[model samples]
Target: MDTDVIICGAGAAGLTLAVDLARRHIRFLLIDKAAGPFAGSRGKGIQPRSQEVFEDLGVIDAIVASGGEYPVQRHYTEDGTTVDEPVVVRSEPTAAEPYRIPLLVPQFLTERRLRERLTELGHIPRYGRELTGFAQDADGVTAEIAGPGGEQTVRARYLIGADGGSSTVRKALGIGFPGRTLGVRAVVADVLAEGVTADAWHRWGDGTAAQVSLCPLYGTEMFQLQGPLPFDVEVDLSAAGLTALVRERTGRDDLAIHAVSWASAFEMNARLADTYRQGRVFLAGDAAHCHPPTGGQGLNTGVQDAYNLGWKLAGVLGGAPDALLDSYEAERRPIAEDVLGLSTRLLEAARNRDHRRGREVGQLDLGYPDSPLSLASPGHDKGVRPGDRAPDAPVTGAGGLPTRLFTLFRGPHWTLLGHGVDRASAPAPRTGLRVHTIGARGDILDPGSHVRDGYGLASGRWVLVRPDGYVAAVLDTAGLPAAEAFLDSVGVRPPL
Candidate 1:
């Protein structure tokens, strides 16, 4: 095989997966048709979950330093009535360390960070290389690509399509993208508008026809505008037209539209692939799911997809069973479907002029509520909830090193967390599990309660957290032997 994996499309998903695979010492190639990284901020808000994934990738600090945080998000009526007070929800860190809130970095900056990380890992994305076609068999996949130089063939054990909504690989595999497209059209423009403060996401509309959102972008007093335009209207975003829209919408006729950084006309749609995998080929990101950007979930969902698939792909590449790969589709497809549903509903709510309802629905942290990956205990309901990304909380060790509990999950091990338990009674080390004893008093729980109360962690109990920060299994310390056996059955042996 030319490489273990051939990832088509060097967008957020593809680049993130490539970086992860590189970290795992897996051989992979990331190809894109674009000459280089696309410029300008497109998908701007990285959600809390996506921020956790960036921390895992060791890039969140740089992202935060480069981007600003938008803490206060408010919902308002079209007539400027405050529907809800600004809610300040702190984005805690995950099971990983260095807790920080989600940053408002443009998609371009995100791509740049991933690209730099990939380069540092000694695997630069192959630019101007487009996947033309591919064929997969029982052993592996062989893809044909048309590059700037010429056509080339790449053989790999696995092929992943991250090439956006119009994914050629998915089409070649005969996967159907089923979803609905909105009849109304929207024009998204990122521009520098003076006088608009960079504090919150300003949304205005009633339930039905037109809604507008003005969100801050990093530097340059820039903001991204998204709303409905006339179906018959052609989106010619000349400087004058953009300034007129700003003045008309915000009632600031003196506002100057400096640079129309990026402008595009898009029809919102909610779609998901019938299947995420076919034999040795797999699909992720926009290739597998497409949804309206109501909750700023487009890029966030794609990055999360990469996070979920990365370690699993790494495990399989490291000689684990192929069944592990099946879990990717099982776990992520539902999340995508849920996101699509929520985003569609949010768009509808915006159309109906129900800004409060829309914001409430959009702010919901929808997670895997039904997955067995959660701790199956009766009273424990905090920390990382099922179907939701784990939240980070600060913890101090006996040595006084102020470490984030998530730091214990740095490597590719299934972390076994023992809250309020004595270190002497910790679970025995196995092949793929890392055991840590976290305090119930200071570290494991959020403020306002004991760690045990925060995460519902009982003394001498084991909480199995997946590499991606999802709760994989929870067990009483007495069931440690059984848990070890289960881990073995899943091919995840705790480190010895």
Candidate 2:
């Protein structure tokens, strides 16, 4: 095989997966049809769960640096009256949840941060390359790709489609993308403009009528323009067309559009693929699911999808059972289904002029409770359960330095966190797994009782965290045997 995996897009999803594979020392090819990274602030909200995923992928610092909090939204009526509201209800940060509020970073900046992380790991996405078609067999896949240099055929153990909603890989595989297009239509653009306050997201009309909205994008001088388009009207994506629409809607001769950087027609679509996997090829992000932009779920969901698949791919490529790969679609497809419903509801609410966004949009509460991989202990099903996001807590590492559970889970490794357990009672070292004992006399000291409170575990309990930051199993006193069995079932091998 030429490589272990071939990823066919360089958006948030593909870039995330590439960074993950690179960190794992996995051979992979990352390519994008575009000549360079995305240039728009299409999906700007980095939900809390995705923040944790970025932390593990080693790009959270850059993401946090490049993004800011969502600004208050100011809506204007036809009578020149205005009302103000926060974009999203803010949540206070706790020891377990450090990132509570959503961060407003442009999609382009997010992609750049992931790309920077990929480069640091000695990999770069091949630009100007398009996946024209591919054929997969029992062992691997052979892909036909078109690029600036010409056409080339490449072989890989697996193919991943992260190529956006209209995915070529999904189409070629004969997978069904079934969904309805919502009645909402708009023309979105990124523009350098004047006469707009940078502090608030300005809206021209109430939600009951056609609205023109301009949101100040963080880390850039441009604002993202969203103007309603008539259902039957042909969208004019030209700079003049967008400028005219903005002026016409806002009724402001003072507001000037100096430059149009990027523009596209926005149609709210709620779609989900019939299946996330077909033989040797898998779909993730927009390839597997599409959502309305209301809840800011599209980009964050897609980023997490790549996070879920990356580790599974690494495990399978390292000689795990072929069946281990099936869990990807099973675990993520259901998530997409639920997210589709959520974003659809949020879209409806927006149409009704209910602009209140709650903590649900933060995506911190999403998990795989019913997943086949989630094994809950019989009576220990209280605090953090299997398939739940593993919460972080304050801890003291060697030298009495302040640390966090997230710090131990930062790298590309499974974390075995034994709360209230001593160092002598910790589990033996395993390949690709880090064991941390958090107690008074443990390897890492949790004097604050944060771990106990966060995990809800006493002296004889333990938790096994997946590489993707989900709790795989919560164990009781006799946790070792069950944990070993769970690991074996998932094909975790002993160190050589």
Candidate 3:
């Protein structure tokens, strides 16, 4: 095999997965049909969850430094009536890691950042390489690629189709992409304009006839206009057409289209593959599922797919149980399906002509509930319950080490954090579990803090945190014996 994994597509999902695998010392070949990095900003928002993933990958700072800040978003009726108060959605309190709200960096920039990081790790995505076809068996998968030089054969332990919606790999694999094409088509344009506030995402709703959302891009007076066209009106989306729409909608005839970087018509669709894994070839990102861009979730969800699959792929390749790979589809498929359903609902709400309801659903932070991962310790009361993202908390010890629970969580390792347990006095020779002890004077509720408070973790209780920053097991002092047994069941050895 030329590599451990062959990732087809250099978009956000593919690049992120490659970088993550590289970090874990997994060999992979990442290919894309494009000549090089993208030039335009296609999808331009990074949700909180994605920011956390970026931090784990050690690239969040670079993204923040290169990207512009877009913190406020507002919705208004066509007559210029404010439908809702300007919502401050994207705010991160930490300077070292500031990307809580969805950042306004363009998709091209996001890919560039990921690529740069990948390069730093001594891996570069092979551009102008398209997957012609692929076949998988029990041992490995074989792929045919058409590159600038010509056709070539590449073999890998596994293959991932991160290709876009019209995926050739999916077609070659005979997988069905089930979904409905929307009746409405939206025109999107990225340009620079003066006299426009560069902070908020301004949306003007035309009661379902049409809608326009203007978002600012940093470093210049550039903005992105996304809106639906009239059902009955058929106009070519030339520079003149887009300018006319801006003038008629914003009442600003002077809104110059500095440069129509990229213009395309897109439709909202709700689609998902019936299966995420097919033998040794697995599908992810748009190849697995695609949804409307209404909630700004397309890129975020794809990046998350990489995060969920990267570690498992590395584990299996590194000699972990093959069953671990099954969890990739088990876990991420449902998330993508849910995101598809959510985006569909959001698109329908926007299409409903009810401005208030549309705005409400659009801004709602709909997350996955009822996950077994959210289980809490018995009789625990701190908000750091199970299945939820482990919150960062600040803690100060008697010795004033000035540590944080999240800082201790940096890794590819499962961490066991105890609030008051003395590390030196506790059991020695702990293997597979990185244990850290925090004394009093820690603030767990602060947004900047990595540790959450309500897990019934007292002076002697232990909190088991996963590599992805979710609580896997919580152990009261009395339940230590049972907790050790649980750890063994989960394929982890307890402290000796």
Residues 260-347, candidate 3, lDDT per residue (tens digit)? Answer: 7767677767889888888888888888888787667788888888887887787677555677677677777777877777777767
TM-score against native, each model: 0.85, 0.97, 0.84
RMSD of each: 4.2, 1.5, 4.3
User: What TM-score quantifies how close candidate 2 is to the native fold?
Assistant: 0.97
Number of clashing pairs per prediction, in order: 24, 0, 13
Residue pairs with colliding backbones in model 2 are none
Ten-residue stretch with the least lDDT total in model 2: 420-429
lDDT of 2 by residue, 1-496 (tens): 3888999999999999999999999999999898988988899989999998998898898999997998999988778888899988877999999999899999999999999999999999999999988888899999988999899999999999999998999999899999999988877888988889899999876574457888999899999998668777787777677767778888888887888888888777899999999999999999889898888999999999999999989888887778878889888898889889999999888877777789888888889888888876776847899998899888899568999989888877888888766567655666877888776667788888898888888677889999988998888647677787677766575777
User: Which residue ranges in model 3 land beyond 4 Å of their true spot?
Assistant: 71-84, 87-100, 194-205, 230-235, 248-251, 352-386, 397-399, 422-433, 440-454, 477-496
Two-way lDDT contest, 2 vs 3, winner: 2
Q: Worst lDDT window (10 residues) for model 3?
A: 355-364
Q: How do all the candidates rank in terms of lDDT, highest first?
A: 2, 1, 3
Q: In model 2, what is the error at residue 94, expressed in angstroms?
A: 0.5
By lDDT, is 1 or 2 better? 2
Worst 10 residues of 1 by lDDT: 355-364
Between candidates 1 and 3, name the one with more favorable lDDT: 1
lDDT at 494, model 3: 42
